[model samples]
Target: MKQINSIEDNLEILEPFISGLNKYLEKSRSLSLFKKLPIRDDKENINDRLLEGSYLFSPCGVELRESECNSLALELIDLLKLHLTDRADEINTISDHLLNEKINPHSIILSTIKNEGNEIRKKIRQLNLPEDLFTFFLIYLARPFREQAASYLLEKIEKLIWLYGYCPVCGHWPVLAHINEESGERTLWCVCCNTKWKFKRTQCAFCLNENHESLEIISPVNEESYRIHACKKCKRYLKEIKSNNDAMNFQFDKMYLGTVPLDMIAEKQGYIQESILTVRYDNPAGNELLMYRQKAIKEKISIN
Candidate 1:
């Protein structure tokens, strides 16, 4: 495995992409592009749902207003074209489609949030856009709104009693893990909503496999702070950063971006990166969690 002294070294290697991404992120966060999403403040009700292993936000339950989605999509595409010079022409084409209303931003936003990869691919094919590039742009366009909604919901709830492997906010699998140097506690980070929650150190985040013999942690030589936690039973791996100081200074997003080499190494070793749409229900516990989520979604729809 390739070794690096610090995350900054990795960032230097990915400077061109990182530079463009950083600008996009900064500009996106500055604008009040999204409408204020509804927040459920019924603590007792929330507690009951949490106890039942239900996540706060269901895939289809999130209300991304059409106007806001359209506005944000145009803004993001324009910014992508400006900062990401290599893809200017492609992004400009996407921008024109959004401006002309040939592509419905609202539908695309919903499909992306729901992890409907096939639907996204179909749209890309019809439009003749670059598949991977378009998908990447769409994911970023939807991120800010999801983060906004999750922030609102997070403020109202006092305690999160969720014990499930997937995110408590978005139902997406974790993209990274932070291990406290002193406490040795593992906290999982949701890729979609940026929600954080404590999870079992020995358990597999993908499949919840708890056998010590089946779980392994591997780190690159001379890189003590970084590690990859792999599950032999499920053939899945999660990137981890073990922080020496208080983990407050660690930026999960940057760390995820900086650890591209770890991802390559894990993939080369036959470990699979679990998709956002995948929900593990093979175990009885996982089944119950799924049931609770279904019930929550139904209730949310009925109320709406």
Candidate 2:
């Protein structure tokens, strides 16, 4: 509930709880690091203009197709899954270390699994990707400013938050994730980097609604400290909770989404969420009626 400047600030305040996410949420029942992966061509032959009035942008941005992203993401997730199990803590530890110094945040992501040891890479190698395409990944990992890439990626993802209404990373809509820390309680994990962001407990992520009638509380209502917030129009939900101790669970949204049974229960109660934290993270300028989007601004000529 303490106000923080940025997502990173919230993560800092919730550090102890994030560290303990592994223990509180058993990894066994958790979704694969690649949960809800889209098939490469899931949106094939569909026109995108239908949603243009809604201020939605394709996450691929003409660089790639939805299918291509899904395929690449699947490949990448496979890599993380192959290795994330035993090395989850190590990878996270190194990620935090790099975050501390703001070093090569992406490359500094410590993977205990050797690159050569990854099965996905072996499969990719077998595919014989063109040198340029294959090398792009290597360059991405070793980019000069990884934090820039992370920021760019994160910002780009924020845009897609509206399009698909799901976390760009895990592809899983949040169920009942908890922050598990004194400060980070009821925060969400970036479906991509698995980063955590502390959002206001009662506010709606899409429309920013706090009206009691518009929002519904689903499962885990019995926990006293936590409950689900669902917006019917937005088709999204997030968990909010109270905590007194500092928690070290890094598996923030993982455990939250793992409660499939609870998700079913919520869905049955006539409450549903198709996305998480998408609109809230993206640019205020990007929405329809912004300073740049105004028709007057478009027609006006420069006085200078």
Candidate 3:
């Protein structure tokens, strides 16, 4: 891994690819599927649920209408093939199999949300498609929906107390962390749904190890604002950005893209990325809330 001494140097190196990907993301966000989708509001006993380690919304509880799912999936697939010219051939092959086999796009979207990569890989193998490429594509295709849902639910829970390592909105692990320059407070940013939540600075985001001996920060030379919070116990690392100003306006997505070298460096050091799903099912209250929200979706009941 090449040593990235400055943010500008890193961004300059990845600018071309990042620019194209940003355009694709912008066009994808403008799809009609985001407009027509409904987001359920669930605020009943919100803090209690958080205390019980129950995420605000389970993937099963979030309703993705079949028509919208199919339309959005097809549109995203087309957009990827159009904007991402490098992957055009691969996208075409996967899209052909996905459509011709009459596979319900909603099922794949749900599976991706639930982090069922094995099922997706199985399907990809059956279709004779590239496993890693199609799996990433499916996740990218499902991103907008998760992000939209997160946007709707963020305000409802952002101020509430949530101490968990995973996302409160989507049950996904943090992809990035933001540290306040003045206060030294840490906020974990979710990879799947783009949600942000407050977390303890001394604790490891992956294993929640707070012994201080098992946790360490790896900072690149000449980079004051960037570092990696790594856990020796789990061997998982979270890339972090220290916010100097306008923390609310920080483009985490762009920062994440610009910091690819950080991932490479961390991986080279034998640290792995955090798991997609957190271990929340062990709590009965989490299970109860999951079951309740799922039932509400089935009954068409708007949770108040």
Candidate 4:
């Protein structure tokens, strides 16, 4: 585990939520839920996808047992319930559904869960459950599981690494991009499974457009060090932070939330805050990635 500088003392804006997340993450690895996750495997798995010199599982390819997923989700819900006093009943209901395999955490975060005009959305509103809050809960619960699964495959394949626009592990797009202060190289950070990969500095992660004219860089006047890399081709944006390699302990999850203001700014400029590459590529994982990516491209092309 990497050590992070304490930001708890400075937290007052979203005190309960932000501080709780920081505190929870500090000890998340030690929790029994996280410990139960499978570790580095001695034997290579048959289902691991070998892509661009890395071994990764598809979004649905994580080999976690249903029992394991339920246990992890239950524990995570219990932890979240501590901070979410107002939503205890809703949390309990969520717990029941998760335990019964009636709901999947990954699907929710990946935006693949379609409960529109369903009882679930009605329940969500009735219980005052915010979509972002629910998604956060899901991501936190699923992170350790995905991380452990990826590690198992990476251990067997010594050269396992990815340079693609999408996550090699989960096939999701990066939530943040950062530059290596020393090498000046670029890397994409995946919030889904906490994976990082080197990527082409000039290429757009979304539409894979390499035209410099189509890429616009926006920087906040207050925070000159941070940048919003927006692609004119796809109208999609990714936040970039300047950090040294030694800062591997950077709290990317926390940083991502803290930079919501930047996301808003990007969105106001006609660029999207979310990933444009949500689709699963053509693989055994089916068209999950491909469909999403194609839709994003089609929408942007039509708009322009």
Candidate 5:
């Protein structure tokens, strides 16, 4: 793989993805799905959950009516199709299939398998559809809801979040991590819900293994601000950004975009990205909060 040496190169690689994201954020911001969202009372208490070793509700656990989710998915498809030029024809087919379905967020089978933590690729082998489409749809389709939660909960709990590894709110593992320049404290960043929380510097985010000898740090020559934290036990890697003056000015999303080289290098060394299998709350397709909304659907057919 080619090394990316500058911000321009990173933008070249990430432009397609980032361009669509801004539009998705803007359009979704205007939706009523966020208005009077049904956030369970305890979900907002970030510090409380950390103290008890309990996780806040995953965004998937939040209930927005199906119609709104479907609408968000449809809006996302327009932006997604633009970025997925290689899969344009396949994406069009997926779009058609989605529009024809009465259900929102489309692809119930894939979503169900994803929620159940089943091997989706093997289950959908006969379908022959592009797996990328399914993955993107499942992730971004729920963004509208997740972003809403982030907007509210991030500010609601005005305390120093103590948990380090997984997100306190969404329960998903982090996409990126960074260290404070002064204190040298580390924090993990969640892309799914845009969450940032403090974690132990020496501990591996995946297994919580703090044996310094079992952990490795990979840094490129001349790039003092960025490094890869690899845990030998879990074989999972986290991209870490050191919060220097210049680094502090860069947005986390932009930093994530520019770190493509880091991800490639880490993966080449046999370390996979850090992602935990999100626990299911209720139904096969979404969070347990969907249970209330899914009563009619559940009555129609058994999930198992």
Candidate 6:
């Protein structure tokens, strides 16, 4: 295996997967699917499996057996059932043969750069979930794949959205951030929409707060480069690194991947938000902006 020297290089490894994604996008963005998806409403709520998605955090480095993936898929149906009469026991059963250690629900989502290979995408469609869910599942995948998969899911669902619309994609909300890469041009990338708009990276993305007093930079006791960007105007914050060494041009998506624990601390202080991924769970993938917390997946281990 060769080391990836740049983000562009890593993204290339995903070309085969991205190529397939281009087709999924053209077929998915339909208004009919976005208007009113038929899932159990709050008052009519009766499904048990539906709750699982909200709680579904695909664990890391964990291997899921075909039995487990199928079982979870069954749970997905359970989660999908809008009516109590829906029989996952009869209509939806896990294909015991479909399990593969690679079917990482967590890894799949995170590989925003890598669209699930055809086998996984085919398996996802096999679940027969509401169209919105497929979108969420796709974008919720934080990997670069989400970048394209979310685009495909939204286009399939037929929704009109800007590149940087609010965190409408996962229907999750956003906790805002300010990123200033090299050109001194700061872009506001919504965790949900995958939209990038220009703003003063130094100013608050949420409230445009400029007072140095209103903003605070909280750093870890030991780590010098990493710090939290907190704003008093909106009472929101995000994380950033001002390093002495510029060799590492940090991409936030990849940068924040290993820093879940720090996000927890930021949220605890009420400095900024964490899961402000989107407003609704139904929003198509990649469109939802996400914080580190929403990206948290429990540690998974398949005993089998």
| Cα RMSDs, all models | 6.4, 16.4, 7.2, 7.8, 8.7, 16.9
Per-model lDDT = 0.72, 0.37, 0.69, 0.61, 0.64, 0.39
Ranked candidates, highest TM-score first:
1, 3, 5, 4, 6, 2
Model 3 TM-score relative to the real fold = 0.76
The prediction achieving the highest lDDT against the true structure is: 1
The model with the greater lDDT, 1 or 4, is: 1
Model 2 spans with C-alpha error above 4 angstroms: 1-186, 220-226, 232-235, 240-249, 275-304
Q: Give the clashing pairs for model 1.
A: none
Worst 10 residues of 5 by lDDT: 289-298
Residue-level lDDT of model 4, residues 1-304, one tens digit each, is 4332222332344466767666655554554433333333344452233432233554432233445555556667877788677778767777776666567754443333111113334545755666665656756766665565556545566654453577766666788888777877888887766777778887888777889998988876656557788899878888887777443676677667666666777877998655322334544344454456655655654576
lDDT of 3: 0.69
Model 1 stretches with alpha carbons more than 4 Å out: 1-8, 15-41, 59-67, 82-102, 277-304
- The lDDT-based order of candidates, best leading, equals 1, 3, 5, 4, 6, 2
lDDT of 3 by residue, 114-221 (tens): 666567667767777876567557756677777777666665664767766777777767888888899988888876777788898888765566778888888777
Shift in Å, residue 303, candidate 1: 33
lDDT of 6: 0.39
lDDT of 2 at 137: 30
> How many clashes does the backbone of model 3 have?
0
Model 4 spans with C-alpha error above 4 angstroms:
1-19, 22-55, 59-71, 78-129, 245-247, 275-278, 283-304
Per-residue lDDT for 1-304 in model 2, tens only? 4321332344454454334433322331232222122223223112232122222223331222233223333333334334445555434443443335433322222110112214323433554433332332332232112222233334433332222222333222333445555454345544333434444566564444558787877645344444566776555566544455443454444344334344455566666544222222234422232222223322331221
RMSD of 5: 8.7
The total number of steric clashes, by the backbone 3 Å criterion, in model 1 comes to 0
Best by TM-score: 1
Quote the positional error of residue 132 for candidate 1 in Å.
3.2
Q: Candidate 5 residues 1-304, lDDT tens each? A: 5655654466677777786776777787777664345355554455655664444554343445566767767777787687768888877876876776633353452243234445544433645567656655665666556666666665566664554366666666687888888888777876666667778888887666679999999987677678999999778889888876433344677677678788887888999874333444343553343233234333432432
**Model 1 C-alpha lDDT per residue in residues 165-270, reported as the tens digit of each score:** 7787777778899999899988898767778888888888766668899999888777867889999976989999888755555677777878877887788889
